[model samples]
Target: MRKQLTVITALVISFASVHAQDATIEKIREQGLTQSKVMEYAFRLTDANDSRLTNSPGYFRAANWAKNELTKLGLVNAALEPWGDFGKGWDLKKSYIAMTTPYYRPLIGFPKTWTKGTGGLKNAEIIVIKAADSAALEAYKGKLKGKIIMLHRTDTLKPTYKPDAERWSDEDLSKMAAAKMDTSRRRGGPSRNVVGSMPITTRIRKLAEAEGAIAQLS
Candidate 1:
């Protein structure tokens, strides 16, 4: 009698598990096929502000919009809690940069954040520099005065036939899961064994300013 009771209990548990799995699958199908509102919410959030930097006015507007949206969805206590003060905000009114001399081309570039803008349309010569360190920078000491500096070599672009977006196949996912992590020490730690000086990106920017370069392009 006890053995029969144990078998019966096992059967009941298995049945309950199957029922729960079916319910979960049904919920996923309902949400994926019919009841999802992802795009609607995304459009509302993005359209509320042009730019949403943390300290900008547009950010506050977007925050309020999100709070209101949550409140409309019957969420309780939707509020923007104030964190500590961030730095000052900035708005870009008008920006235009183009290559006029040697070839008339519309240059694609974005100004660095928190930097002063070029006063209206001003033209300057492009000075290409391939300096990787302070020692290499000595060659262009007086040459960068009143010029736009190109600090890095341009990469060649190639056309591809593949689609822009794709879902990972089962094989691709399995390969990613099986990939090994690199446990080796990085080269630039605080130890004496590390080779090479500090990074040249910031140092190059400072050198450009000191040398009177109008702008530095990466």
Candidate 2:
């Protein structure tokens, strides 16, 4: 009789716990449906706090707002914690580029992060640098001054064949769900050669700066 009573008590307690969980979940659902601030939060995070680069002014604004918002929402220990020392934050105030030689047409371009700006409006000539090797760059060393440089070749636009949006097929879904881990790659093979070797892009930028070039366009 004692064993049976203990079993019954355990089952009653389990059912009561499940019922409480369901009631709490239903309350949450009702609150979300009635007082949803999803759109408001999204607007504040994205539209209001635009240009959220790390450690930038916009980033701090968003972070402070988020911390306070969480606190308002009854979350405990809502605060900003520093990760470590980081470089100076950069933000773009204004950007403008245009073609003037052949015809009057505004060019679509944005300043790269950590790139030095041209200070003000510049009407410098654009030069395409097609150096095959670092040795070939010597020829244009003195000539790049006051000129905008393009290090790489211009890209050719390709037409897209796939639709913008589509539902996944049965085969695609099956492949995604049944995917297994790829164990072919070894843990830590010999790392690629990076020491004392500068990338071609970095080399180009360094050369351009050393030669007093106005700016480099990708």
Candidate 3:
């Protein structure tokens, strides 16, 4: 039993190592364009589709669209892998955001992919909560049980304002390397708004019984 377990563990680790080596992530990183491709894909997917609907005929259209693009890019065996059963479906056809009051302005955001639609209701009041500490958090206990929680930390927005490119001298580069890089990127700050979907059972499919809100805006 011990020898068999050791063999199994070795095989598992070997398979993991191979998987890591063959990852598309590693190839993209090697090309030094992970950030650029992300933006390009984001624009192509979200902006091109205007997707913020559910069972969106557009969503399935976009899926087929992606399948075509993936095959074009030489991803062998690229195809839609459908999961067993979602008796009904949903998808986004369009999304719009603006501050209608307190001065009209555009709210900068991209909807979380596959989020449910606004169901013909074009506008809704946005409830913002600062989920910071015990007291501030408690202030929102029952209230925020269903409201959108917008965390106010700008940790992930790094100081990306490099005005000009230059080759630093060895001494300058060495000194820069001595200082630690920023750690803010390690903080997983954004919340996944997973409550857009209405729940399902064999007999009934009810609206999202959110722990309290219609949707999480963030």
lDDT of 1 by residue, 1-218 (tens): 99999999999999999999999999999997898888876776677476787777777878898999899989999999988987788767777778786778887877766677767777888888887787887787788778888866556889999999999999999999999999998776565422343466667777789878788776
For all predicted structures, in order, the TM-scores are 0.69, 0.82, 0.37
Q: State in Å the error of residue 10, model 3.
A: 43
| lDDT of candidate 3 over 50-157, digit per residue (tens) | 663545666666677788889998899888887776656564456677777778998776667655665654545565654433445445445544344454434585
Cα displacement (angstroms), candidate 3, residue 75, comes to: 17
Highest TM-score: which candidate?
2
Candidate 2 stretches greater than 4 Å from native: 28-36, 169-171, 183-198
Candidate ranking (lDDT, best to worst): 2, 1, 3
Q: After aligning candidate 3 to the native by TM-score, how far in Å is the CA of 151 from where it should be?
A: 2.4
Candidate 1 is scored at a TM of 0.69
Candidate topping lDDT: 2
Better of 2 and 3 by lDDT: 2
lDDT of 1 at 87: 74
Q: What is the C-alpha RMSD of each candidate to the true structure, in Å?
A: 4.8, 3.4, 14.7
Q: Which 10 residues in a row give candidate 3 its minimum summed lDDT?
A: 198-207
Tens digits of per-residue lDDT for model 2 on 189-209? 444544323465677788888
Rank the candidate models, highest TM-score first.
2, 1, 3
> Global CA lDDT of candidate 1, please?
0.80
